[model samples]
Target: MDFEIREDRTAQGRVKLSREREAYSRLMQQGYTNAQACRVVGIDSRTGRKWRNGRSADRRQKAAPPINAVVPPSGPSRYLTEDERLHIADRLREKATIRAIAAELGRSPSTISREVRR
Candidate 1:
């Protein structure tokens, strides 16, 4: 089977469909929604949907991988440390309130609440 590749131009005649698809995929990978990515790539929302749903007219197999499969940036987490967790546990045993614990640790009450829940 012989396949001839022809570039499909967009309305602006500056960008091609292939380029739009590539941009869309990259945007989606960076946590953009189909519509949002499509807008950024200057393509229609329906086209973005087709790309996301794997119904491309060109029959190309372009699929974005799972977001979790994409490795996150390596850095120190902006979260409570082991010492903070130990302090939280000690405070909890002492029947300290969430707000009080947060005040003692200079953290938000919600942070303490979420940490305790975890």
Candidate 2:
């Protein structure tokens, strides 16, 4: 038996279905529902279901972590006034943990650490 590939029906010009399927599978593994994965990969929900069911073969695991699961840039630090820096330093001198300082300032521990380290 011989099979002929259809040149005109090829996915060369658009995103490959295989790639989409893989991405869908990966998203599902990462806890995204089929609907959510479909929306992220820009495919119809039914198609996503089909891919998940193995009726089709688009099997591209998502190459990276989900966008929603990633931490977004927190943006630049607010310039601390001299008094504020002194206050933070004073708190640190008093042996306040980074968590304590961040809680007091309502910021992240990383922010507090960076501020004091500078």
Candidate 3:
């Protein structure tokens, strides 16, 4: 028996293949099924299934940054109370810049700007 293979003549063919490869690898690493990984990586279920079954041309997932090593910025302080706003406003009207007010109150320049604007 002879089998005839059809070739994809569309640009989506290669992109779909690459997506399937990426999705399948992530699925294996994250301990998810093809369908779940496909959902996460934005690929179709049928393509994901094929990749999971070892038709994948590539098998690498993008590594995420270490969560523990990530340093989130220290957020604005709650020290700028309503009373502080009244005082800062009084100071700004006395010709104090937002930076000066921020330094005096130990807040961000943006904080001072927002306070005066509001």
Worst 10 residues of 3 by lDDT: 62-71
lDDT of 1 by residue, 39-117 (tens): 6666778767766765424457645432232457464357888999999999999999999998998888999999989
Write down the TM-score of every candidate: 0.36, 0.34, 0.34
Tens-place lDDT per residue, model 3, 16-108, is 555445445745565777667666655677755555453523457433222122334466556577778887979978998888888887788
Better of 1 and 2 by lDDT: 1
Minimum summed lDDT over a 10-residue window in model 1 is located at: 1-10
- lDDT score at residue 100, model 1, on the 0-100 scale: 98
* Per-residue C-alpha lDDT of model 2 across residues 18-100, encoded as one tens digit per residue: 55666766778778998888877767797666556644234664333222324344653576667667878999889989898
Model 1 Cα shift for residue 92 (angstroms): 33
RMSD (Cα, Å) of model 2: 12.0
The C-alpha lDDT values of all candidates are 0.71, 0.66, 0.62
TM-score of predicted model 2? 0.34
For model 2 the local lDDT of residue 45 reads 93
